[model samples]
Target: MKFFRNQIENKKDKSKKEDLAGASASASENYHSLLECLHHTGELKSQSLVINQLKFMLIYLETMADPEKIQKLILPALHKCMSLADLDECISSAGSVKTQSTREAADLLLEGYCLITVDTCSEFWLLQVRADIHRPPLEPENEKVVRGSHIGFVEDMAVNLRMIRQRMANKKLVFRYLTKGKETNTKIVLAYVKGIADEQVAETIYRKTEKIGADMIFSPGFMQEFMEEHPYSPFPQFLQTERPDRVMANLMEGKVAILAEGSPTTIVMPVTFFSFFQSPDDYNSRFLPGAFYRILRLISFVIALVLPSVYIAVIAFHFEVVPSDLVIPLKTSVSGIPFPPLLEAFIMVFTIELIREAGIRLPTPIGQTIGIVGGLIIGDAVVRAGLISNMMIIVIALTTVSSFSIPSVEMSASLRLLTFPLMILSSVFGFLGIMFGLMFIMIHLCKLHTFQSPYLEPVAPFTKTQYKDTFLRFPIRKQHKDKASEAGGNKANK
Candidate 1:
């Protein structure tokens, strides 16, 4: 208890920043001082001077949460007598992963989770309660590539941060934890390559991030929403991936990654458009196979986005271009069906969506069984009963399969929801309507910026050198397998 007191009396030079006391006390007075200052709230530009009012102190320390673990242990205020606290046990019981004592003495036994107290009774209790929650780890739902790492990001922040830290060997891979959400005190990590990441980008993150004052920064998705520069764009300007490999790749490219404490996925900023369609396996696998997968993903994206609208165009307005032989088969299938081509398409689309939603919301085993039965019984029974044409069934199936082909599940889901409007447009202006809609979407994408970089980087800006890693996975080194081994994965692809 006396150790901290001695250090405070003799150690501080009073020149550089000191842990200035809020009061000059008898050292016996009962007072509260905020401890283990994990974060700063209220104001960024506040004065650093300490105010001594009566017997109280509100000392602010750089290291807040677990104060005992701090490396430099010159506690000049340790001489005050108190009982030794089982602080670690209490904190762990409080459900935190690890807890460190903020101060040395037990009687003056106190650390500021919010405020630590001295000369007080033992009734001082801990503040802040965090419920551990996050999304489950699953395969990358949207950006699935066969050759990549299988695990996806879960909602737990610590777990997610660990995933990022595990990959990089460089100490320059830095993480700074900041607390936000005035009530929630939600933790967020700012990550970057100290040397590789642009200095301005880190500063920009710090500036914008500190301004956030939500009641509860509970979700990574929610935090990302508040912190990002643009809010209304239809296209995602940042790359939000659960895959650590993808994060490592972005780190290598000098991009910043932000992980909120509760969200399963972290977000990478200043993402180029070409980066969104990419998968980690594109760089991990052989170049030729990687290129093949990239082309497949690109094709799938194009199909998911435009196929139905194209179908509506051809069937409604370009039927004259259809060969006579195929037309008879199509006519025969729809012979008893009373609806127009557009109306029939709508009905089919609506039915498939209902089944998909049901499949996803239900439990896994039940959902799988339901999906099988729903697809077989519903589609086959309806066709057999002559309610809808066989050709209509085929179109809906193609759309569903193509929609799943997208790598990021969120993107796929977005594509699915967007298809209905495009379908309607196709019925109105045929291919021209689809073209108009697509052009508008593209403009939104190009206008979007992730962490100040062109969302469509390497494309909007047309960087030929950057393409060495985009779409096509080039070798780690042009010559020598030893160089490939030395460089780890393909540096160009990064």
Candidate 2:
């Protein structure tokens, strides 16, 4: 209450200061006579008309005011009126009437839409301005993979649209632009194939985007929370790809893509679970390594999400399930640990998350050093100090490693967040909790949709032909032109 009162007093002091400032500003002498001097207003008292209507008056007026004294005086806002009046007219003609403030007065003195009044001749100025401020093009940090195309999304929306369009040569590929931000006029574009993509998906993208009412939106990530299909779900409902080729592929898959002006990344909508796992490099790189890497990523994703919880559940309640040989090792590792297995696991996992978050927020070199030094110092010290068991450290390290394996940064973030609740669930019900959580996850995955397509498509639908790309990648010829494709079964990129 004391702090609150102080805060209120501070606000009152600020208001009084503002009021004093306003009073000081308004206390200045009225420059009405000086303002009148800006124009030769003959109607005002003490008017010193400068421009002569007659040649005789010009010389006489020059003499009336001392020539040396008049020479020192200057009119600041003086502007020559540009008007078309008939030279042949004797005081009147059809088009000779001066169009002053009514028709075209705004153009005088390089005015910005404000009308310039010079005895009332108006000139309308055409005013148009584009954004002058722009962030320099930089490689997308979110979607970095060693072997993939180095060209990532930049802040320029037009450049992003061109990158995706260059890959998708189909004339049916449509890019629709809309103006957002009431004051900023931020340009946002939605790109998709006209016929190849589903019409409903395009509508959904536009509808969701139109509803975004933010004071400012910097990245596609800004729109994610407001426009997501499931607000409460941890999984990313949209797939944001830096690679244009990846976006083009999603377009072919009947999904809609959104590109924000001044944002380098393009958001592909109705993204499936497989879309996050798949990458442009997967299609571009050597098939065997690519397929193996993709499979490993899926495995790691599961491990990242479940490893800690499994360790806790097993150690806390399911010890009978462990082999006798392994039991001694586990017992020895956790022997001196004071906390329960569940609490120990939580401590390690939470600490790892804290380190990861810090690393992400820190500068590149510093962040890398922190990740390395922090991991080594903390893990070694904690285990040696007997604050946490070695097994707990291993489980946390593995979980962190698995979290990093998923290709999509956003998807990995979603998976990482889910680890905590799952950990808690496992702590209480053991394997039953694991089974229930997995079932819930599966149900949620089945229910989630991006645009209009099921997020767990091909897998949920159980398409034999589609799994060729999901579980493993079939060679291009086999996927595109082989006998199987000709048999009207394969439609991987179509």
lDDT of 1: 0.64
Candidate 2 per-residue C-alpha lDDT over 272-355 given as tens digits, one digit per residue, 9 for 90 to 100: 888888877787788897889889989999899888888889888889988988999998998889998888887887788888
**Can you give the lDDT of residue 26 in candidate 1?**
23
Q: Which digits, one per residue and each the tens of the lDDT, describe model 1 over residues 176-226? A: 788888877778888899988998998898777888978988766677777
Quick one: best TM-score, which candidate? Answer: 2
Clashes of 1: 36
Model 1 is weakest, by summed lDDT over 10 consecutive residues, at: 43-52
Q: lDDT values of the candidates?
A: 0.64, 0.66
Per-residue lDDT value at 190 in model 2: 84
RMSD after CA superposition, every candidate = 11.6, 12.3
TM per prediction: 0.70, 0.73
How many residue pairs clash in all the candidates, one count each? 36, 10
